[model samples]
Every structure is written in structure tokens, then in C-alpha cells.
Target: MTFKELIEQRAQEKNLLFVPMAHRFQEGKQVYRLGHVMLYLDRNVIFVFNGKTWVPTSLQSLLDMAG
Candidate 1:
């Protein structure tokens, strides 16, 4: 699925507002925000914003932690 689709599905499931960044995942910019969590994906690696910096994490880890 596309990034928008993924965001929509997760937002519906969690009953939260998720906003995708105005641009696609390129270089190292953030891609989306689920509630207050900002995330970036590049080269199959996911990085989550931890208030101070982007930390590498897995998709499963992110979902579990997010929930």
C-alpha cells in the first residue's frame, strides 16, 4: 500500500489523526505523524522521532510501541 493508505488505515484503527508530511520519504526527512509521533522510513529502515532525535526502529517495534 501507499504511504497515504497506510496512514489512513492506522488512523482508522487507532481512532487518531495521522498527518503525512507534505513530501515523500527522501533523503532523511520525516514522512508522517501519528498523533504526536513523527516517523521516517528510508532504505527499509524506520526512524521514529524521540523529541530529541530520530532513532532507528523496526516496523513491528513501532506499531507495538505506538499502541
Candidate 2:
């Protein structure tokens, strides 16, 4: 499945929430190469590192973005 698909599936299965990250680089100034997709599943919400700091993005929002 595509990254979006995986995210959606996870959201459905676990009612996960996504938070986009704000920092694109690590402390070493090394750029992340995760291809605009990263997820941190917390008890209340999932954190998504979309090339930046963590920001909340809902499953519906993800679908909209994909489209």
C-alpha cells in the first residue's frame, strides 16, 4: 500500500491522529529523507513529520491532500 493508504488504515484501525513536524533537519542539521511522510502514534493522537515540526492532520485531511 502507498504511504497514504497505510496512514489511512492505521487511522481507521486505531483511531490515530497525525501531527506534522516543523523541523526539517536534525540537531546536526542533517535533512530527513522520509519523503514527506512520518508518523508518531501517541495515546491521544498520531504525530506526522511532514518535513517540519509535528502538526495535527486528520485522516480526512490526508485524503483531501492526496486527492
Candidate 3:
């Protein structure tokens, strides 16, 4: 799903599992677990929580993997 769609789903769903992933990214930065989404300060990579676990991937890598 798209980012907007994902966000909407997250907002609507109250039972979605959320887990924290605090780590380094572009100096002193950490990742946040908001429902099913993981938002970061830097654009280097994205870590999405895929139900069972977290999916750590870059934008290009995700697109490449989809193809």
C-alpha cells in the first residue's frame, strides 16, 4: 500500500501491533514505531513493521525487490 493509505489504515486500526526500533541514522537519530509504520528522520532507509516482524529496507531496495 501507499504511504497515505498505510497512514490511514494505521489511524483506523486500533489493534495493530507496534514495536520500537531505536537506532542510529545520520548522526543522533532514532526510528519510531507508530502502529504499523516506522518513521525516521534521515531518508537513508525505512523500517516498516510487516505484521510478524520489521522490514528494514531502502526506498530503491524496496522498489527493486518489488520488481
Candidate 4:
């Protein structure tokens, strides 16, 4: 799916909240999460909550893994 579609899908998920952050990074812009995954839109990464820190997942990597 496209970026916009991804964003829309995430928004539709009742358990997930799509929050935009002011912070900027080389990979992507900052985003906050109230769920297990923190999504960064700019870099296109998903930070899985590991009880402490967020883990990064590349969009391309996820797509490849999905296929």
C-alpha cells in the first residue's frame, strides 16, 4: 500500500493512535504511540515496544517480509 493508505489504515485501527511529533531525524519525522508500536512516518519505521526501548523496522524491510 501507499504511504497515505498506510496512514489511513493505521488511523482506522481502534487500538492505535496516530500522533505526529515535532522532532526530526534523518530516517523520518517523530511520531508517538499509545500502543505496542511507535510509528515514525518520515523514516517509515515501526518501533516495537520491547518493555523499554523502541525497535526500528524499515518499511521496505516489512514489505519484503510480508511477501
Task: Report the number of the highest-TM-score candidate.
Answer: 1
Residues forming the 10-long window of minimal summed lDDT in candidate 3: 58-67
lDDT of 1 by residue, 1-67 (tens): 8754665686678776666778756365657876666787666676887888779886556666666
Q: How well does each candidate superpose onto the true structure, as a TM-score? A: 0.58, 0.36, 0.26, 0.38
Runs in model 3 with CA error above 4 Å? Answer: 1-29, 33-36, 41-43, 57-67
Off by over 4 Å in 1: 1-18, 23-30
Evaluate all candidate structures by whole-model CA lDDT and list the values in order.
Answer: 0.69, 0.48, 0.48, 0.49
**Can you write out model 2's per-residue Cα lDDT over 1-67, one digit (the tens) per residue?**
7654466565556544443456744332322212245544444343456666866667555444433
Q: lDDT tens digits, residues 1-67, model 4?
A: 9774675464555434445545734244555543334445544445543457656766444333323
Q: 19, model 2: CA deviation in Å?
A: 17
Stretch of 10 with least lDDT, candidate 1: 23-32
**Every model's Cα RMSD, please?**
3.3, 9.1, 8.3, 6.2
Clashing pairs in 4: 27-43, 28-42, 28-43
Superposition TM-score, candidate 3 onto the true structure: 0.26
- Residue 62, candidate 1: Cα error in Å is 0.7
Q: Which candidate is the best by lDDT?
A: 1
